[model samples]
Target: MKLSHKLYPFQNSDPTRKSLGDIIILHGLFGSSKNWVTVARFLSNFGSVYTVDQRNHGDSPHSEEHSIRLMSEDLEEFIFDHKIQNPVLLGHSMGGLVAMYFDLTHPGILKKLIIQDIAPRSYPFAYDKEIQSMSFALDGFTSRTEIDSEMAKYVTDSFIRQFLQMSLDRNEDGTYRWKLNVDGLNHARRVFDDVFTFEKTSETPTLFLLGGESEYIRDSDFGVMDHFFKNNHKIKIAGGGHYIHFTHQTEYLEILNQELSFHS
Candidate 1:
């Protein structure tokens, strides 16, 4: 029950022509609006676009509370504040799950809904070790080399290490701290239980895009996903992982264009 404190950071894209419409894109867990810059620029051709950095990620304010419901309501408030009429809403992974909860609670405002690489089910997460591992890496930050070396010990994946390193904020006093509230995320584990739970179907026209290589969405959850997102479309990006929008930008843009055309 905290203030909606202008939490997320966002970028607005100018359209090439008269704006076709408006769309808001939300990034996945540990991601920020910066990650979607390319996609935002590409999608801006079809409409004015908004890419947001959700709470605890990117440049957003770190709150003591983090939950899908809280984040969804924040989005709803943003839509109303901006007077964004029937804007297309797209979210990836954790953001996708937040989008689903938002639609379920507040329907009819969206022109269309797009969810990527997640389903309407509670996903089991064991991110504590990974998060602590990052903190553990920050034990002694004499230099970036020391930090990187410690991070390498905890996080073996070079790509993830590079991606997560973006969250580090440097102090004038020659110290480094994480931009994200890792402890808040640890406390938010309870919110996971409330990620996806409802019976009534949503009327918002929806598209579910997934990376074929991502294990986030299971075969069993497809039926539940269809149950809620009754008016929906589904696509799988071959050889793509969780970050389909980044890896398959062209294909992702084409699919988005097609959806825009269909809605138009």
Candidate 2:
């Protein structure tokens, strides 16, 4: 229940009006609500937008337990506490998996769902080397520059390194640390080996935005996807990678508005 969030409200000239349904935007693993600043700003023109930091990420309290089921249940609690009625759930990667689980388990709560760059199938992940590199880069860091220098040795992409650095938090004592719960995350990753299965269908309208340059979703995966989703739209953003919302914001938003029909 230590989830931190930011609420972006739509601009109303009339000063006495409210928008339509609320939008709950969930970020991927090692991500926070800050990543969706642009998306939330744009979406706020249509409705109230709430961007949350999932457990073990951002400002959310670190937890020893992390999984799709746990995160989804946390989401349900957030919905109940906030008293948001049938809000749209928009998530990317790990967040997307959480959204799928939440919608399926709590049948009548979701208004619409937008999952970006993730499928319902089990994704092949090999994180040992990356985790090692991360530990090495994060250890004994006095400044962000020091961490950047260390991370540069392993992560070649400048953008990705910078993005990863966002998860780093500096202590009042000038020491740096990661906001992610690496131990819990490793456990959650192992659980994903036996990902959730959809034995039944639901009518919740869902839109899946795919990264054309990413291989997360395969043609074969759509069979099981179609079986579970009764009303859904699958879109591919050309030249976009895993973080399509950041890599290709303009096109991503355009497709989102068109597919989800969120317009002001």
Candidate 3:
């Protein structure tokens, strides 16, 4: 049940005031706790915020397997270890799939749920091309520009290339390494693809946000999604892509604040 976590408590003027609800952020595959700092920091003003490094990512211990069930258990253990009560579960992409599983299995643990850019169904499209691209660039590159040049050939978007590049680290021997557990992740591709599926539905208030330009969620997944999240509202961010939170932080933040207030 032990987790390598970095916790940041939101400071309030009145120390004696009762504990308000907190936010627990889950990052997508290949993403670490650092990915949610911007959103978490902004939400901290309302209450405590936590960003978790999922197993096999970030400073969190690496594991040979990265199943959704194991991930939910890790999250459950994390909440118990931190003694966080009824915290809001916020997740993006792969993280969103984890949140859905958690809410189904541990309904009482959350006050509300926010899922960004994913649905409760399997997306088996081949991402091996992207994985291959990452593998090629993970080796030693003399300069950042060299890395960008290689990534640009596969990633298409400049912003996403930059975001992915942030996870690159240079070793003492000058070889560039990725913070993500590449071998473990690439091996668990099928499991990752099969992570999301509808289970027991909960009455918890659910909020879904999507990037208008992304094909991750659409009319096809809407029927299944509506089944579980009966009291749900999906908001689409115009002029945004898959990582809408990053691309439209201000708009996303405003919408998030409004959603939190609605739940309160």
Candidate 4:
């Protein structure tokens, strides 16, 4: 259960000044620790910040299999390895799902949980199209510009396509490939499709932030959310999409600061 992690520390000065609670950020599937750099830096003002790359992504070791339970165990070992306590858990998309599972299974390690734009219920979303596009680009890209041109056909958003293309790497032989564990992710598709399920018992304070335009979190999910998170508050940011933290960093940071102050 030796899980790898990357630690980034910063200064914080609250009245208590007693380690204003560490913040652990988790990225989504196909994403790496790099995704949380901006937000993590901002949160560092409130406490020490740690952004983890799940097993199959970034510098972390890759595995053929992936599961919420296994990811939770990895996180447990990570927290213990780093001796982190009362961490403010912030996770995006798939990362949020894993965070929810971790907080439910190991309630004592985390003080507060922040779930962004994802519900615990199973979602019908499909990443097949994107995966196919990535694979196509990986098959062979004469140059980065070629990959970008191909991706444009499937991905309309120039920014998102550019962000995704960052995962593509060129080898010494000039072959293009992806840094992600694509095969493992494709085979474990069910795990990605399955919605997170857990009984409501833990009384940990949780915040659910959803993007107003994102379909991931909707009014229908509120009933179950109310049941699962006894001490919970749900907020939606207008004009925000699934990637709210990135799309609206300043706004999201302001809300996060308010949340920290409430607990401070």
Most accurate candidate by TM-score = 2
- Residue pairs clashing in model 3 are none
Residue 72, candidate 2: alpha-carbon lDDT: 85
Give candidate 4 misplaced runs (Cα > 4 Å).
1-4, 13-18, 137-142, 172-175, 193-195, 198-200
- Better-scoring candidate (TM-score), 3 or 4: 4
Error of 4 at 11 (Å): 1.3
TM-score of each candidate structure, all chains considered together? 0.88, 0.91, 0.90, 0.91
lDDT of 2 by residue, 103-123 (tens): 877888888888998888777
Spell out the clash pairs found in candidate 1: none
Q: Which stretches of candidate 3 lie over 4 Å from their true place?
A: 12-19, 137-140, 172-174, 194-199
Worst 10-residue lDDT window, candidate 1: 1-10
lDDT of 4 by residue, 148-264 (tens): 888777777787777676667788898987777777777777775554554645578999988998977778888877776788998899999898898988899999989987776
Model 2: lDDT of residue 70: 80
The TM-score obtained by model 3 is 0.90
Better of 2 and 3 by lDDT: 3
Model 1, CA-based lDDT: 0.76
RMSD of each: 3.4, 2.2, 2.4, 2.2
Model 4 TM-score (2 dp): 0.91
Model 3, C-alpha of 69: deviation from truth (Å): 1.5
**Whole-model lDDT, model 3:** 0.80
Tell me how far the alpha carbon of residue 86 in candidate 2 is from the true structure, in angstroms, after superposition: 0.7
